[model samples]
Target chain A: MTSLRHRIQAAAVAAALAIGALTACSGGGGGSANGPIEYWLWDSAQQPGYQKCADAFQQQNPGLKIHISQYGWDAYWSKLTAGFIADTAPDVFTDHLSKFAQYVDLKVLRPLDDLGPTSDISDGDYQQGLAELWKGQDGKRYGAPKDWDTIAIFYNNAALKAAGVDPSELQNLNWNPTDGGTFEKLVAHLTIDTKGRRGDEAGFDKAHVKTHGLASEGSGGGGWGQTQWSAFAGSAGWQATDKNPWGSRFNLDKPELQNTLSWYFGLVRKGYMPSYEEIGGANAVGTDKQIQSGTAALGLSGSWMISTFTKLTDAAGKKLDIGLAPTPIGPSGKRASMFNGLADSVTTLSKQPENAAKWVKFLSGAECQNIIGQSGVVFPARPAGTDLAIAYNKNERKLDVTPFTQQVKDKTTFLFPVTTNAADIAALMAPRFDAVYIGSSPISSLNKLNNQLNDLFKVAQ
Target chain B: MATATPTQQQASRRKAPTGYRDDTRLALLFILPALIGFAVFMIWPTLRGIYLSFTKFNLLTPPKFNGLDNYIRMVQDPVFWNALKVTLYYVVLNIGLQTVLALVIAVMMQRLTQKTWLRGIVLTPYLVSNVVAAMVFLWILDYQLGIGNTILAGLGLDRLPFLSSDTWVIPTIALINVWRHVGYTALLIFAGLQLIPETVYEAGKIDGASEVRMFRSITIPLLRPILSLVLIITVVGSFQVFDTVAIATRGGPVDSSRVLQFYIYDVAFGRFQFGYASAMSVALLAVLVVITFVQYRLTRAESSDLA
Candidate 1:
C-alpha cells in the first residue's frame, strides 16, 4: 500500500511539472492566437507618443493588439542582439542608418521591396541625400527614414546674462584651436571663479578649476557625432572608408585626420573642455549635471535634451532655462554637423509579415510622424511632419527647434558612414578615443587608427 | 508429468507476459517530452547554425551557403590574429592572478577562524552577476567622480589613467576580473583546505614540526587535487572572458584590449561571418580541451602517488 502511494505521488509530481512547462510555453499576453503584436522601443521619453500611434493603428485594425516594451538605449541594443540570435527579433524596430549596415549584412532585416515599390517615397518628397540613406548595398531599402538629429550647442541664458554678455552673439561663434574664438570670450566672461577670476585670466588654475567654461568633448566621450571624435574625421576631411555609401579603402592615413584629433585633444590639453576623467559617469548625465549645477557655463548637446533639462525643477521647484546654438566649426573653415536618422524596419523572422509591414508603413506615415513630432521625441523625417515639429517647439515648448531642421536643409551635415563593417570599425574606434580622452595617449595616435581603419575596410571589401 | 508441467510453465513465462507491454509504454511516456525538447531546442538548432555558418546567411534572407570561403578568409584575417593574441594574454593573466589571489585568501581565511563573517563578505562580489559588477567597477574607476582618483589626490598624487592607456587598460581590466572572481575560487580552495584533516597537522606537531614545515608537508599535498581542479576551471573560464572586456575596455585603445571573444563577436555580428566565427569557436574549444586534459593528468598523477 505504501509503494502504491509513492507511485501515485510521483506520477502527480511529474504531471504537475509537465503542466508548468506547458504553461510557460503557451502563456504570456501576446502568445495567444489572434493576439497583439509586440513592439520594443528604447526611449522612455518617447513611449507616450508611440502608444498614441499604437492606439491609432489599433483603431484602424480592430482585431490586432500592440504591446510595447521600453528599455534604455544600451539595454535595448543588448536585448535586441540576444533576441536576433534567438530568432525572436521584434516584428518591427527603429534602425539607425549608421549601424543598420551590420543588421543588413547579418540578413536579419526584411527588405521592403517585396512589400511595395520606391514610388510611395519620391526623392522630391524628402530632404536631398536623406531618404536614400536607408538603401542597402544591393540597392534594396531596409529602413524607412523616421527622424533626423544634428549636433547643436545648448547653453544657459541666465548664466550668460549674469556674466554681462549677449547670448545671441554666440549664434555663429568663430572658433580656432589657439583661441576658443568668440566662444572663448563668452565662456571666459561667464566663468566666475571663487576668487573672482575667470578661465581666461592669467592666474586661473586649470588643475583646480572652481568653475569650468565648457562641457564635455571627444569621441566615446560625449556629445553627438559632431562633439565626439568622429567629427574630427569630418574636420580633417577623413571619412571612415573613403568614398560614398561604402568605400573599398580606409582613409585613416589622412594627415587631416591626425590634425583633427590633435586639435580636438587640444581642447582638454588647454583647459577648454573637461577631461575624460571629469566627464566620467553616464553618457548623458555629465553635460546635464554640469550645466544644471551652474558649475559649468556652456554645454553642447542636441535639441532632444531640452525637455530633459527644462523639466528638471530644482529642490525648490525652480525650472531651468536652456538656450540653443549651432555646433562650433572645427578647423576645416567649414562647419560640418554629423547627421543621424532612424529607420523603420521589418523583421524577416516575423510570422505576420503583412501585419508587420502595415505597422511599419503606419509608423512612417505622416499621421504617426506628426504625433511623434508634437511630442519632441525626435526631429521628424517627413517634410509635413517636421513642420509640426517646428510649430510644436515654437508654440508648445516655447523653444526654437529650427537649427536642427535647418541642418537638414543646409547640407552641412555628414551622415555617419553606413557600411557592412561599421560595427567592427566602431569597435575599433571607441577604445582609441577613450585612450586619448584619459590622457594616457596622444591624439597623434590617430595615425595608427587610420592605418587600422584601412586594413579593416580592405578586408570587408 | 510434474516435471513436464514445470517445463510448460517456464515456456509460458519465457514467451513474455502482457504486463511487459505496459513497461514499454511507461518508458516511452517518460522520454517523449525530453525527445521533443532536444528536437526543438538543441539538435534542430545546432544543425541549423552549422548550415547557416557555411552560407552568406544574414538573418533577413534565406541562407545561401558559400562553402569553405568564410574559413579560408578567416586564415588571412588580421583582426583574428590580433584578437587571438589579446585573448591569450587575458587568459594567462586572469588565470595567474585568480589562482594566486584565491590561494592566498583561502590560506589566510583558514588561519583566521575568528572572522568567519569576513569570509562570507569576501565572497559577495562573486555572488553578483558580471553586469552588476562591471557597472560598480565603472563607477569606482570613473576619472573624476570615482574614489580611485579622489583617494590618489588626497594622498598628494596625480590621477592615474585606468582605462585609457593601451599599456594599462588590459592589466587594469584583468585586475578587476581577478578581484571579482577571486572570492568564489577562494571559497572552493577553502573547502579543500577544510578537508585537510586536523589529524595530519596534529601528527606533525607531535613530531616537533614547525607550522611552515607542516603546511608544506601536509596542506600542500592534500590541497593539490582542489588546486588542480580550480586551475583547470579558472583557465577555461578566463579563455572565454567576454563580459569583462565588453563592459570595461570594450577591446579598445587601438584594440589593445580586444580578445578572441571580441573577435568572434565582430566576425559573427559585425561582419555576419558566422561560419568564420564558428571555426574560431571550434579552435578555442580545442585549446581549452588540451589545457584541461594536461591539468587532469598532472592532478591524477599527484593524487595516485598519495593513494
Candidate 2:
C-alpha cells in the first residue's frame, strides 16, 4: 500500500511537469512561413469592415490566413505590450500615432522600407501627409495609413428649432477668444432654464437650468482637445508644440491657447455648458447621450462619431432629428480641424512578417480601403476611399459628411500633434487640464505645466 | 479489530526503524509541485523586480543597467509622494471602516445564528470583481442620472458629487471597497469566533454576567490574534487599491485618488518608466513590510488565549 501511494504521487508529479513543459514551449513567434499571420485592432466599429478585407486577402493568397482580434481601446495597448514581452505579439496590428513612435523606439515595429510600395499601391497613393506621418526618426516608413478622422459639430435639430435658430445660421459662424463671438450668442440662445427661459433672456437662472447649450466631454477632452477646443485654439493661431512629430518644446503657455481655453471652460461658469462637477470623473454622462436625451443642444466630437450621433434615439426609442456642421471660424479667419489617422504596422516578432506585410499592403491599398469606406463607419485614407465614404453616408445613411471632408479639401485641417513620449506628455497634462476644468486649479497652471512638459523632452534628449 | 497492548506497541516501535524516512520522503514528494509553483511565480518575480529596480526597461526592449538613477529620481518625484499620501489616506479609511463593520457583523452572527448559508450570502460582494464593483457603483453614484442621486433628490436633498468632487472621490471609492470587502473579513472573524470554547461563555453566564460584559471580557481577548491577522490582510489589500480607481476614475479630478499601486501602473504602462516604477514598488514593499512587522508586534499576534 505504501509503495502504491508513492508510485501514484510520482505519476501525478510527472504529469504536472509534462504539462508545465508543454505550456512553456508554446505561444512563441519564430519568423517562420508556416503559421497564420495574427492581426489585431482595437476598434469594434471597424471590425466588420476589416473582416471583409481579411476574407478578400485569404482568397487572393491560398493556404494563408489572417486571424483578427479586437480589444477595447483602454486594454489594447497594455495587452499588446504584454504580448510583446511574451514574444507572442500579433504579426500585424493597427497602430496609433500617439503610440507608434514609442513602439518604433523599442524596435518592436518592422520598418516597411522594403515593402513600402506594392505593385498597385505606393506611398504617394495615400492622402497627402498621412503616409509621411508613419515615418520613424530614421526616415523609414513603419506603417501604412488605413484611415483618417477630423472633428465636427453634431447638434440636436429639435433644440435649434425650439431656440428659434436656423440650421444655416451655424454654417459660417465666427468665434473669438475675448467675447466668444457669434458662437457664444448661438450657444446662449439655445440654452433654456427649468422654467422655459432662454439663457440670454431676463430672469435666467444659471443654477437649476433645464438644458445646457453645449454638453461637456467629461474631463473636457483632457489634454487632447481635438473634439473640444482644438479647432478654436488652432484657428486662433495657437500651436501645441514648436513642431509636431518631434517637437522639443511645447507652446501651451502662449496667449492664444490660454485665452481660447479660458473662454471654452468659462461656458461652464455661465451655465451654457455642464460644469465639471456636474459631469466629470467616472460617472459623467457622455456628450452624445446628453444631446440625444435633450440634456444639451449640441456637442463637438470627432467625425468618427457621425454614425453614433445620427443614430441617437430618445428614452422612448424615438429617433431624433440631428444636424452636422463645421466648426466655427476662429480669430484666424479660417476654420480648422485636427486631422488624425490610423495605420497598420508589422511587428518585428512576427512569425510571418512577409505575410503580415502583404496584409498591411492590402489594408492600405485602394481596393480594401474602398471596401472599408463603403461601410461608412470611418473615412479611408485614400482619396477615392474617402470619396466612397462620403457617397455611402449620403446615399445610405442620409448623413452628409461634406462638412468633415471639406476641411481636408480646403487645407483647413491641422495634423494631430505628434510627439515622442506621448503617453508621458498626456499624463503630465491631463490632470492639470482636469484641474482647470473642475475649477480647482487656475488656468495659469497650464503655463507651468508646459515647462514641465518641455523638461520631459529635455530629459529624453 | 483487536487493540494492541502497551508491551506489543513498544515492541513494534522498537522494530524495523519505523519507516519514518520513507514517510518523510512521501510528504516531500506530495508538496514538491506547490514548492515549484511558489518559486516560479512568486519568488522569482520578486527577485527580478528588485533587480529591475536598478535598471531601465520598457516592456518591449531589453533592460539597460542604470545604477541608482531610478531610485534617485523617485526620491525627488512629487507625484510619488502624492501617490504615497493618497494611498495612506485610502488605506486608513478603507481598513478602518472594513474592520469595524466586519467586527460588528461577526459579533452579530456569533450571538445570533451560525448558519453557513447566511455566511455565503454575506460574502457575495467579495465574489464580484473589483472592476465590476467599481463600474456598478459609478452608475449608482452618478450625481445627475444615478438612482442614488435620484433618491436624494426625492428626499429634498441636494445631489452629492460623489466621484466628481476631488474632496469626495477618495472617500466615495473607500466606501465602495468597504462594501465589497467587509463581508469576507466578517467571515474570517466569524471563523475566529468559532474557535473560542462555549465553556468560557457558560461560565460567565453561571456567574450572572451580562451579555455585554461577557463579550467584552471573554470574546474580545480570544479574538485579538485573528483580528490582527485580518488587519494585516485588509491593510495590505487597501494599500494596493488599483482596479477600482483604474476602471472608475483613472486617478482623475487632479489626482485626488491616485493610489500608490495605480501610480506605479501608470508609471510602468502609461509612461513606460519601468525602472522608476519598480523603484517605487520597492519602496512600497519596504513600507508594507515595516507596517506588517509593527502590526504584528503591536497586536501580539504570536500569542492566543484559546491556545
**Number of the top candidate by DockQ?**
2
Which digits, one per residue and each the tens of the lDDT, describe model 2 over residues B1-307? 2556877886776775768769889999999998897567545555667788889987556789999999899889888899999999999999999999998889889988778798789899999999999989898888778899989989989888888888999999999999999999999999999899999999999999998998899989999988987887777668778889988888877789888888887888677777778788778877776787787789987788886
DockQ of all models, two decimals each:
0.13, 0.32
Model 2 CA lDDT for position B11:
76
Reference contacts recovered by each candidate, as fractions? 0.17, 0.40
Among all windows of 10 consecutive residues in model 1 chain A, the one with the lowest summed lDDT is A14-23
Provide all candidates' interface root-mean-square deviations: 12.4, 10.8
Candidate 1 structure quality by residue, lDDT tens digits, A367-453:
888998888767777878778778877887688866566666767678766666676666666666666666666777767876776
What is the lDDT of every predicted structure here?
0.68, 0.82
Question: Which candidate leads the pack in lDDT?
Answer: 2
Interface RMSD of 2: 10.8
Show pairs that collide, candidate 2.
Answer: none
